[model samples]
Target: MSGTLGIDFGTSNSAAGISVDGTPQLIPLEGDELTMPTAVFFDFESKKMRVGAEASEALLRGDEGRYMRGLKSLLGTRLIRESRMLLGERLDFIDIIARFLHEVKTRAETATGETFTKALSGRPVRFHSEDDAKDAQALVDLKECYARAGFDDVAFMNEPEAAALANRDVMQSGDLGLIVDIGGGTSDFTLFRQKGAQDIDILGSYGVRIGGTDFDRRLSITRVMPQLGMGSPIRHAFGNDTHLAPNGIFNDLATWAKIPFLYGPDTIRAAKDLHKFAVHETRLARLVKVLEEELGHDLAFAVEAGKIMANTPDVENPVIRVGMLKRKAVLPLPAEMMTKKLSGLANQIGEAAEATLAEAQIAPDAVTHLIFVGGSSLMQVVENALTSRLPSAQVHRGAALTAIIDGLALGTTQAF
Candidate 1:
C-alpha cells in the first residue's frame, strides 16, 4: 500500500499526520503515539541511531562525548555538534540530524507497516540566519540529508500556510483569521483570508526567533544555577559543563526561541558556541528528566532549596540534599524563579505578535481568529500573551503540536 505523508520536522519535536476521509489525524509516532521528541541517540560503539520517544530517554543518559539530540532545528545546515564517547570516538552534528530524520521516517513507516515514499515537510517562513542572508545553504544541506535518508521526493511549504490548510474545512465564506505558531525556535504569524473551502489565501506572514527554549535556559542560568552558585568551583573541577533546563522548562522551551539565553553578551557567546551549548544545555534537560521520571521524588528540589535557604541547607539522604553543586548534583529551582522567567518571555511574545501585525498591515481589530500552532504553543505564557493581543479573535486548540505537519501532509497530497 502507498500513502502520502506530511511532516512537521520541528526543532524540539517531530510529528507526522495523515488525512483520513478529508479529515486530518495526527499519525502515531510509533503507532498509538501522537508525537516524537526530535531527539537523537547514538551508540558510539555500535553506531546504532535512535530517535523519537525511546531516543529521548536514552540520550539524556548520553555520554558527554557522544549521543546528540535536537538536530531538527539544525536542518539545512552544515553546522554539526561533535560528541566524543568514552573511547574518544566523535559524531558529527549533521550526521546526528540526518540519523534523527531517518529514525522519524523509519518509525512512521514501521508504525504503518508500509513501504511508502515521498513527503511534504513544513518549513518556517523565516529561517534563523548567522549574518542575515536567507539560510539557503542550510536548506540545501537538509534536502541532501533527507535524500540520503532514502526519501525519493521531499517538499516544503510555509509552516503556518500548511497549518491553515489543515483547518481549511473549518473556514467559512469571508472567514479571516490569524495563525500564531510558537514553535521550538521561532514565533511566527500568518494572516489567512479564506475565499472558499479550497481557496484560502495567505494574506501575509511574519516571524521572530523567540520561543520556549529561551525560558528553560533562563531557569537554568538565572534561577537554578545562581541558586547553586554553580561557577568557578564547578568549572575548575568538572570542566565547566553541567548545564540544563528541566522537562517542564524544556516544554516551555519548546514554545519557541532560537536560542536559550535570550539576551546579553552571554547570549551571543552561546549562539556562536551553539554546538557546545547544545551539549551543555541538554545535559540540564537530561538531569531534570532523570530526576522527575527516574528518581520518583523531588530530590532535585532539595538541593535547589538549600541553595536559597542557607547555602548549606541539609536534608535526609532519601530526600533532596545540598552541597552537591560542587560534586555535580541536581536541584529543584524555586517556583518564583521559573515564574519570573515565564513573565519575561510573555512580554516578548506580545511584542513580537504586535510587531508582526504592524509589518503585515493588519490591525488587531482586523483579526477575526488567532490560532496557536506548534509544540511550544502549549505554554500558558505564550497562549496568554498572544491571546491578550487579539482580544476580539479566537485562538484554536494548539494541543495537537503535530497539527501543522498533519495539515501540510494533507496539503501536499492535494498540491500533487
Candidate 2:
C-alpha cells in the first residue's frame, strides 16, 4: 500500500508531509522550504499558471497576470462556483485551488520519490463560524478539491486539534493544554488533556472566522482606504446634495479574496464615475487609477507588509508604503493604533477560547499549558488577549507554520 500524504492546506500558506518510521517528515514544497504561500498567478504573456513564491514573484515583478491569494477563504462562498476567464481558461475557485494542490502533490512526490494514495488534511474547526450550512459545504468542497488534486481518498482533522496532537509532548501526563492556532483567515482553539507520553484526550475545539487577513482588512479600511476616498463625499448627478462614497468597492479592495474580482470593467467604470462626481476628486482619482491599473493586490500587499512591520518590536516609524499609488505616499501605522483597531477582534478570539473551556466544563486556570501555533499567533495583540484570559498557563510556541502538517503527517499512518 502506498503511504498516506498529510496536507495542511491553509488560507495563507500550505505544507505537505508523510510519516516515516512513525515520525513526520515534511516535504520541501518550494526548494528546501517546508511551507509555500497559497497564491497563484495566471500569466497573460506566457499563458501559464504559477503557484507559490513564483506566483508572488510574478506579481512583484509587475507582470501582466491575475494574482490571487486567500483562495481557501472562497471555498464556502457563492464566488467559489462562479466561473471566470483566466489565461485563456475558464475556471472557478475550486479549479484554481485544485491546480495549486496538484502542484504541491507533484512537488512532494518528486522530492520523496514515493507514491501517496490517500491523504490526511488539516482544516479549521469552522470555515464559516456564523453559517452552519456554509461550514459543512466547505468540507464537501475541500474533499472534492483533494480528489481533483489526485488523492484517491482523504480524511480531515481540525487544525487546532492537529496542532494539539503535534504539541502533546510539551505537556506532562495529566497536564491540561490549550492550542491556539491563528492562521490567515481563522482563529481556532483546542482544549485537551495529556493522558500519556504520546497521547491526549481532546475536550473541545472552537474557531472564529477572523485572523491576519481580517487585521489587514481593518487596518486598510481605517488607514489606507481613506486615501482612495473610502469615506469621502460625492456630489449628486444633478443636484447640490452630496453623499458619502459607497463602501462596496473600498471594502472589496481591502479584502484579499475580493481584490481579484474587483478588476472587471464594470468596477473600473464605477470608480471612474465616482472620480468624476467626487467632492474630493483627487482622492477618488487615486481610486480610479487603482481599479484601472489593477493595483488592488499591490495595495493589499503593502498593507500586509505594514502590518508585519508594526507588529515587530522596536520598529521605528512603521508606515505602509503606498508609493505604488503615488510618489512618496506613506501611511503611518503605529503599533498602538494597530492594537486599537484589532483589539475587538482579539477579544472575540479570547472569548471563543473561553467558550471552548466552557463547553468542556473546564476552568481557565486548569489549563496548565498554552500552545500557540500558526503565523497570526505571533501577534502581540493576540498574545495579550489569550494571556489575559488564561494568565496561569505557561505559554509555549509551536512551529508557527508547520505544526498542523507535522501532526497530520504523524497521523497519516493511522488515518487510513
Candidate 3:
C-alpha cells in the first residue's frame, strides 16, 4: 500500500492496481468489478454526466444524451484538442478524459485506505506508428491528463514490457520470450531475455495502430453497411445506368471513433441528397434514419458485441440486435464470415510479431515461450496466426485483463 499505483488507461477498458504485501492486486473500480468500461455519456435533460458502465446504461435506457467510447483513440489526433458544446458550455476532450481518470484515482484511494500522488501508467510502445512527432505528443498529452487527474507526478512503462515483467518469475534464466499484446487501440510486440526471477533484458519492441476497435469497424463494414445502402445504387446525373452510393458516409459510420463527427448538418444534408437520387431508396432511407436519430454508436456497440460473441467457441451464430432503429432487427453473424473478415488484420499483427524477432536478431525458433496478453488476444484468428508463426515455441497466456497492471505494480518496487 505504500508503493506507487499502476494504472492501465486502456481504449476499451481500464484498471488500476497496487502491490499489497508483495503481491499485486487490482483495485475494485466499478462496484466490485476489477476493470471498468471506457465509456461516457452526457445527459442533456438531467444536465448530468455518467462514466464507465453507468454511461453505457444511461444511453441504452433511452435517455437523451451523447454516448462516447474509444476516447483513447483521440490521443495524437487533431480531435483531442477540439471542443464541443455540452450543457451550454464548451468542453475539451482532454478534460473529459481526465474526469474518467480522476474517478479511477478516487475509487482506488477508497479501496486501499491510502492516498496516491505518484503513478506508473502503462502505455503502448507507439501511439502513432508512422509519425514520430505525433507519437511523442501522445505521451505529453497523457502526462498532462495525469496531472489534471490530481497526480503529483507519473511515469510510463511500455505495455508489452510490463507484461513481460509480470511473467518473468515463471520463465527461467536465458529464456527468450515474445510478448504479443493486442488491446482495443493498438497491437504491440516485445522480445526480451529473462535473466532470472527478478532480472530481465528487453531486446526490441514494435507496435501498430490496430486492434479490437479496428476489427469492429471491419465487421461493421462487411455486415452492417450493406444493410444500410453501402453497395446500393443512385441515379446517374447523365448516364442511363445507375452508380453505386458513395462510400464516404458508410465508412465513417462503420468506424466507432468517428461516429460523433458524422452527425453534423452537412453530412445529414448529403445523405438526404443521396436518398433522393437513389435506386433501392429504402436502404438509403434507413441510412438517413440512423443519422437523424443519432444511432451510429448504438449500432457500433451492437456490432462489437456480436463480433466478440462470434469469436467464442460455443457460439455458432451470434445475433446483433439493432433496437435503436425504427423497426427492431437482428443481424446473424456466422463464425466463418467473422474469421474471414478479420484475417487480414490478424495477419498484419502476426507479421509485426515476426518482425520483432528479426529486429532482435533472433530466429522464430529461438523463442522459448510466446506469451499472449490483453483481451483481444483471445480471438481465434489472432491465436491461429500466432501459433502458425511460432510453431516450435510453447504458448503462454497471461492474465488477459490484469497482466499490464500487475507488471506496473511490480515495476513500482524496482529502482528503475
Candidate 4:
C-alpha cells in the first residue's frame, strides 16, 4: 500500500500526518502519541540505539549512552557536517538525523498499514534567518536527509504556511490573517489572505532563529548558570582577580543544540582550570561535576520543564529542580520571572511579526486576525508580544501541537 505523509520534523519534537478519506489526522508515532520528542540515544553497553521517547527514557534510566536532542537545530550550521564516534563507528550528524527520520517513517507506515514514499515536510520560514545562502543550503541539506530517510520524493512547506493552511477554514471570508509559529528552534510568521474555506493567498513570510529553546537558555543563564560558575570571577596567577570564568562551556550547556557536543577533553580541562581560579570553588566544582557526569541535556530539560511549570496556571513545583546539581537544589523561576527573562526574545519576535506585515505591504492595523501555532506559542510572552503588536486584530488559536502536521496533511492534498 502506498500513501503520502506530511511530516513536521521539529527541533524539539516531531509529528507525522496523512489524509484519511478527506480528513487530516496525525499518525501515532509513539504509542498513540501524536507528537514525539526529537531525540536519539546510542546505548554503549547494550550496543543498541533508540529514538523519540524511548531514547529519552533510556537516558533518564541511567543507561550508559550518548544522548542527543534538538536534531533539527543542527541544520544550517557547521555542526550538520560534523561527525561523532558512536558504538565504535563514526557517524555524521546528518546520518543520525536520517536514521531518526527513517525510524519515524517506519513507525508511521506500520501505524497506517501503508507504505509512504511521497512526503511533504514542514520547515521554518528561515532556517538560518537573514542568511539567504545558508537558508537555501539548509533546504538542500534537509532534502538530502529526507531522501536518506527513504522518501522517494519530498516537498518542503514553510511551517507557518502549513499552519495557515490548516486553520484557513477558521478565518472569515476575505480576512487577512497572521500566523505566529513559535517553534522549538525558530519563530516563523506568515501574513496571508484567506479568500474562502479552500482558497488562501500568502502575502509574505519571515522567520527568526529563536524560539522555546532560546527561552530555556535565557532562563538557564539567569537562574541556573550562576550556580555553576557562569559569572564567577577567575583569579589570575599574577595575584589579580580581573578575569571571569569562561562562558563558552556554560553557554553551550544552556543551548539545546550545543549540549551534545559539549563533552570533550578540552572542555573538561578548561572546567578544571576554572575550578582552580574560581572565586567560589563550590560553584565551579558543580560545573565540573556536570561536565564529568554528562548532564548537559538533563540541565536543559530541567530548564524547559521549569519554564513550562512556571507558565502553567496551577503548578505545585514551580521551581526548576536541577537534580544533577547539588542535591535538594532549586532555581526559583515563576511565570513573571520567565517572562521577564524572555522579554528580549519577545521583542525580536515582535520585530519579525512587524517585518512580515511590512513585507506583505499590510499595516499592523490592517491585519484582521492573528493565529498562534506550535508548542512554544503557548508561552505567555509570545502571546503578549504578538497581541501588543497587532492589537486591532482578533486573536485565534490553532491546535498548538498538531496544527503544522494537520496543515501539511492538508497541503499534501493540494499541489506540492
> RMSD, each candidate, Å?
9.4, 0.9, 1.9, 1.5
Question: What shift in Å separates residue 90 of candidate 2 from its native position after superposition?
Answer: 1.3
What tens-digit string does per-residue lDDT give for candidate 4 at 1-416? Answer: 23678999999899998887667878999987999999999998889889999999988887899999987887877889888789988888888998999998999889888888888899898998868888888888898898888888998899999998888788878999999999899999989998867779999889999989889989999999999999889899786755888789999999988887878988998899999888899999999999999998888889898999998988765899887897878888877778888989999999999999888788899999999988889998889999999999999988988999998887776634
Worst 10 residues of 4 by lDDT: 407-416
Query: Per-residue lDDT tens digits of candidate 1, residues 1-416?
Result: 23666778886677776666766766687647777766654555565665666654554454322333345555543443433332344545555565666776777778767654777777777666343444675667667667766778888777877777766656576777778887766677778888866778778877666655555445445445433222211122236654442233223222222222122354334333332334454444333333323221122233223333321224232212423332455454343344455777767877877876787788888788877777567666667777888898876775457658767767655644
Report the candidate with higher TM-score, 1 versus 4.
4
Write candidate 2's Cα lDDT for 50-162 as tens digits.
Answer: 99999999999999999999999998889999999887778988889989988988888889888887889999999999999999999999998989888889999999988
Clashes of each: 19, 0, 0, 0
Clashing residue pairs for model 4? none
* Candidate 4 TM-score versus the reference: 0.96
Model 1's C-alpha root-mean-square deviation from the true structure amounts to 9.4
The C-alpha TM-scores of every prediction are 0.70, 0.99, 0.94, 0.96
Please give the lDDT score for candidate 1: 0.58
**Model 2's TM-score against the true structure:** 0.99
List the candidate 2 regions with Cα displacement exceeding 4 Å: none
Model 2 worst lDDT window (10 residues): 1-10
- Writing each residue's lDDT as its tens digit, candidate 3 over 128-247 gives 887999998888889888899898888999999989888887688998889999999999998999896768899998898889999999998988888888989899767778889989
